[model samples]
Target: MSFLPPWVGLLLALLLFGALAAWVLRRGLARQAANLAQVVTGEDVQAQAHRRIQQQHLADLDRALTEGRLNANQHAAARDELMRQVLLDQAQAGTALQRGGDGVTGPVRWGWIVLLLGALSGLSYLQLGAQQTWWPVPLSQRVQISATSPEQLAEQTRVWQQATQNRPDDAEAWLTLARLQAAQNAHAQAEQALARVLALSPEPDLWIERAQMKALSAGGVYTGEPWQWIENVLREQPRHLNALVLAGSAAWSEKRHAAAQSYWQRALGLVPADSEAAQGLQQALAQAQAASPAAELAQGVAAPPSAAAPGTALAGDARPVIQGEVRLSPELQKHIVTGATLFVYALAEEGSRRPVAIWRSTPTSWPVRFALSDSMGMGAPPVLSSLAQVRLVARISQTGSAQKQAGDLQVELPGVKTGVQGVVLDITGR
Candidate 1:
């Protein structure tokens, strides 16, 4: 069975109503034509002819009485009868003229009826239908998973689970449901779903998804079993981007910076330079290099005497840095108007409101990157390096002030250590 386009259905409905209107109009016009023809060529003409005949008959009767061929009483009775017939014919003629005038005016009445039908139909559609929301849903876009709230995602997961249960051998269905479950943070259930897919068909993609779900279920710590699954995938398809990124994230979290660098670099080479994936991979590579043991050793080897000396500026220093991209949520962009400013800042986890460092930039199309280093400090002294843990904030200020207030859109990453990267903060709520 072939499905028609949505616009085709709407067009058909409009045509159907238009055809009905035309049929009604055609019926009304035909009825009026019949009435007009009846008045002109029917009873009215017949009645007028009858009246003339009656007058002639009376004249004949009078002549009969003049010529003495008929008696006076007979002529009188015949003239009286003829006069009554003439009066009746005149009444009928008047009625036919009145009916013909009504038929001539029928178009106005039918016109009102047609106009009323159209007006009512339009008003009903406006009130009850999504007249403003008509758009095409391409098959690709329909299949793509969207970011959803927890409640909505939970409902979707349930629906997908039911589908899989009904079709146990459906590998694609199981995989898709696993992806959805993972998106909703149901990591354990997602892992189980992926297991089912592997049981039915052990595909490389399913292996990669299994590794991802394991990593997520363990709070993004891609070590032990999760790392093994990722390594297994990489061995088969060395340049698989998903497996590489997952492996890189795991290695970076465990301080295995060299391995993280190698994996992310491979993944980076696979994407367009200006793509979002490339940007994310670059951030990860930068973080890995910053924390790499070889890089640190090289820095120590290149240090000057003052840099290594005790009681020097570098003696007690740990140059902690926090870097990330921030974006406004797609759903929350409508609240923003002109004069809005984005303030990305860091504050000590348990300390005062004074920021360790802050960066100010005007709002742009989002996923904008910002790096808050010790150099961005306000008034110097107790800088970002001094705070072991801090919270990073991305705020859209209505009044362009550091002070938070009602109606401001903001998001926070709490207890974030320095040297963190790829910390995407979505400013979704006040």
Candidate 2:
């Protein structure tokens, strides 16, 4: 059953239901027909028996009169009595036949039976069947309402607003209303609904979401109350990924490149290396570094005391030696094209777009071992050995292009010290 597709299973179930219903209906109709036949046959049999008995009594009375055993008056009285009894019996049999005819012994109405069975089957299916299984569009995907008319959207918004009002304590209702309002760009109303949701739920993620709504309402500026909410969340859960990302964006908006880098770096370490969120954060970090290289270098030189953490870069002499093993996820193994280019590189900083040392090759097997040193530097001065720490990246490019493209598998290992060994970079995502 699990191997069958949803539609196939649904179809099989419907067919089986139809067959069973037909069988029951046919059997019932046949039984009713047989009962009707039996009622008619019984009436005929009773009439024949009454006729035979009356005929025998009349014949006996005539013979007795002829032989002088009974007189005419006596014979006439006896005949009348027998006839009266016959009429009573006939009357009782007629009543019984009438009752049978009025009940199940009557004619079977094919139209009514078909209609009843069909209706019952349909109702049962509606109650028991998986309704979405046969739908043309899958329900798993989010329904896109962007193409809806303005009037329709307004009607939907009104409905959701009424729902929230009716169920004031329902956090889900409030959250739904907030999302609807946000979709309509009604940021102010969305924020209000979100506030109600936060009051009811009070989860950290909800707080971050409300903070985002506030930022959107404030023209994409996370100042005032939005920034305060983010700060509060960070203070409580310093490693909260969403709060860190939001804080980084806020700092970037304020032209605080170093702070943004720090926040994003911490957030980056929390997510899978090949995830879209990590990629976006890495891109943002690169832009921040490019915008203020001097700040990045200064921050690198005088590292904060907190930078000594496991994921953070440690202050040490630059040693240009990084060795790592790159592997593809089992599911992605079949996607590896023949003669594909494999790029193993090291970034001078955690978020630098340009690679300081790069080693490119065509790999033919799994778990490719790689080593990067100062000699493989793309340029002098800012080589791998000149940096205290570097971020390692391994990519399998189908098109053999140096730039990342669609369908390219890649992975990253950030905050790797210069003399790192046995680093594993798994190309698990595209």
Give the top-scoring candidate (TM-score). 1
User: Which run of 10 residues does model 2 get worst, by summed lDDT?
Assistant: 306-315
- Model 1: weakest 10-residue lDDT segment is 307-316
lDDT (Cα, tens digit) per residue for candidate 1, span 1-430: 2246556656667677677777777877777777878777787568667867876887889899999988988888887887787778778778777778586447675776778578757755753476544444322123445535547766877887899999999876787787777664456677898899889877666787787667655544565888788888889899887778777766655656688789889888998999967876776676567657767776774321321221112211224277678877778877777767787778776533345566666665677777776534332224575567788888887876544556878787888888777788877787
- lDDT for 119 in candidate 1 is 70
TM-score of every model? 0.39, 0.36
Query: What is each predicted model's overall lDDT from 0 to 1?
Result: 0.68, 0.69
